[model samples]
Target: MTRARRALIDLSSTSYYHLIARCVRRAFLCGDDKYTGKNFDHRRRWLVERIKLLSSVFAIEIAAYAIMSNHYHLVVKVNRQQALKWSNNEVICRWYKLYRGTPIIDRYLRGEELIEEEQLLVTELIEKWRARLFDISWYMKNLNEFIAKRANKEDGCTGKYWEGRYKSQALLDDAALLSCMAYVDLNPIRANMANKLEDSDFTSIQERIKQLQSNNVYVKSEITHQVKQPKSLKPFGIRDHARTLPFSLLDYLKLVEWTGHHIHTEKNRHILKGTPNILKLLKIGGATWLEVIKNYSNHYGHFVGSKTVLRAHAAKNDVSWYKGVG
Candidate 1:
């Protein structure tokens, strides 16, 4: 059964979520349509730029992303602590970037005097915006609406451009988080759209690769030793730290490289190489991890985590059964 977004998203359970927004009817609305020979590649850039801008405006961080032909994947982390720390004025400023504030906010920003009642009203509005500034639903709404408007206008028609609603999957542990991030980063490779990470356009992995290349350390030995991930992404911390992705950039890159090769290889008879140590630390079997990434959507529905975490989340939600996750 389909659950409400509110029920599925619990910051207490976990802050990270993987989201997907697909074009209505699965049309080639954002890429080339071979049947029609219509290229809408520019639409991909619109989403990429907007996502980057919105991440800065909202208290959300983009951990991984892949903008595909008709859909996009995002691994986002909502920072409630950061949003709570913002002052009223700061909240208004951030909200105003994406939307025009109400007259009361205008007056507040202009230093005009407000009666006590109006002051209270303005305070309430600020509080609401502050909460919304960190809300995943609000963030997706802002993102989808912008692109929908642009695509509708360009197509000379006005109707639904996206599917009814974006899908969300909760990542409740390091194993789930790591595999989902890799799945997102390797989307192009899986689709045969790009053979190499650097060739994958409009993806976070490609962005990370480009950043390293610009600094002249694109070689494997150097990247494995020293290349820091771009600041635009949530850095995979070098140590096993609290409240962060648990692997270093080097390990992540190597894992992606190995996984990408397996995905591209056609022969099933080839002997599989040994699993990376990171998977062992996470207590995920190597073959199971690969299978999860290979058919990510099939293995998860609403929540993706360890068996214990899944059981606990279901119990907390009063759900008698939780399916599709191991």
Candidate 2:
């Protein structure tokens, strides 16, 4: 059964989430259609650029992402607090970037006084827009809808492009966040689509690697350069920074590379060698981490975290249980 979005997403529990969306019938709409022999590889760029644009407008931050042939994965951090801090005018400005406003909003923007009713309407619209600015569903809706419309127009047809509602998994803790991010970044290697992490096109890991190489710094606590990291993606911070991932970028890169190497070497065999230091700090066993990364989608339902956290989340939502409790 499909649960309500409100029930699935509890910001009080966690702000990070893993989202997946697939093409209808898994038809490779974003890649080369084997049947039609029409390459749609350029569509991947469309998705990436749209994601960057949306992240800039919304308070949500892109932690990790991978654009595959038939589907894509996104690990996002919804900064509700950031959205709350935006002034009404600021909210209106951001909303107008992606959507046209009503005449009343236009008048308000132009410094014209609105009537009592118009003022009330403007207030209501701003509130709604403010909520949506940090909303993951709205973010995905805007992204998927834009791509669907463009792709449909190109194909000269009118029908559904996405399989259905994008799947979401709430990350209840740092461990879950790290693991899910690694799973997303290693998607290409797992699918045998790419042989190396740097060669994995259309992936956050690749972008991060390129940025690090270009900057020529791996051990620095912070990259003070304006181009410290990919502007489209979230920056990494070891401390509890409000707008950054709670980990070091170097550690994350090492973890992804180590995991990818093992995953690419043998899909079924578990090698407990050359585990990264980040894993030790997180206290996740080498074999167990590999299993989770290899079969992440199968290991959880709407929520992913420690068993204790899962139970607490279920109880908080007034449910008896959630899947992946085992």
Candidate 3:
């Protein structure tokens, strides 16, 4: 059975979610089409810019992302509290950037005076919009819809751009979060699109690498870039803030490098050996962690985590099963 979005997204349990959106008919709409020799690679830049712009407006923070030929992956953290803190006027102003908003909101923004009743009505509307500003559904909707419209206009044709509703997987624990982040960051390498981390364009890994190099914090074979984290995406941290990722930039780089080497070797060798210390610190075994980073969606369902955490989440949602888990 297809579960409802409400059932899948439970912010109280976890705010991090892995989202995937693919092009219609699985076409290479955002990359170079070998068959047609059409260079659509520029479209990826459009997506990255739009996503970042939307992130700036919404309370959602992007933790990791990878823009591929026909699809894109994102790990995002929702900050409901941040949205709740905004004033009614501030909410209206922010929403107006994406949409014209209701007539009442328009008038309010135009500096037109409102009566006591009218002010009350506008406040009601602002309240709803405020909630939407923090909503993942609304955020994804605005993102896809805007991109679709722009693409259609550019293509001089109208039809479906995205295949369907974006697929989402909730990260039930830190293990799931870390695994999914690496999976997304290493997608280009896995697909053979790029052979190196810095070569992986339109990915968060490359973005972070560029930032580190620019600041001179990352020198040859040294992890001096511990203090600096990507500003656009969520910072990788231990406990500086509750919203940050559960590891530092240096730790993540090491883990990714180790994972990339193993993945490349595994292509030729069926078995993998050795363990990354970071995984040990997180209490995740090498083989299990490799399985997760290689095939996250196949190994887990709507909720990704250990059996214990999965069971707890299923019980909380009153679900008899989640992708065949009790």
The C-alpha local distance difference test score for the whole of candidate 2 amounts to 0.88
Off by over 4 Å in 3: 109-113, 219-226, 267-274, 324-326
Model 2: worst 10 consecutive residues (lDDT sum): 218-227
Model 3 residue 107 lDDT score: 87
**Candidate 2 lDDT over residue span 1-326, tens digit each:** 98889888889889999999999944576777888888888999999999999999999899999999999999999999999999999999999999988988888889997789998999999999999999999999999999999988898888899998999999999989999999999988888889988889999989988888888865334454244888889988775676678887877787888888777777467555877778889888888898899888888999999888999988988888888787
Best by lDDT: 2
Question: Residue 186: error of model 2 in Å?
Answer: 0.4
- Evaluated against the true structure, the overall lDDT of model 1 is 0.85
Listed in order, each prediction's TM-score against the native is 0.94, 0.94, 0.93
Put down candidate 1 lDDT per residue, 218-325, tens digits, no spaces.
536535434566777887675555545678766787788888887777367555687766877777776777788998878778889877888888899998666654
Write candidate 3's Cα lDDT for 189-283 as tens digits: 99999988999999999998888888777523556425576678898767455877877677788788889888888858756565666788888
In candidate 2 the C-alpha lDDT for residue 39 amounts to 88
For each candidate, how many residue pairs have backbone atoms clashing (under 3 Å)?
Answer: 0, 0, 0
Which 10 consecutive positions of candidate 3 have the poorest summed lDDT?
Answer: 218-227
| TM-score comparison, 1 vs 3, better candidate | 1
Q: Candidate 3 lDDT (Cα, whole model)? A: 0.84
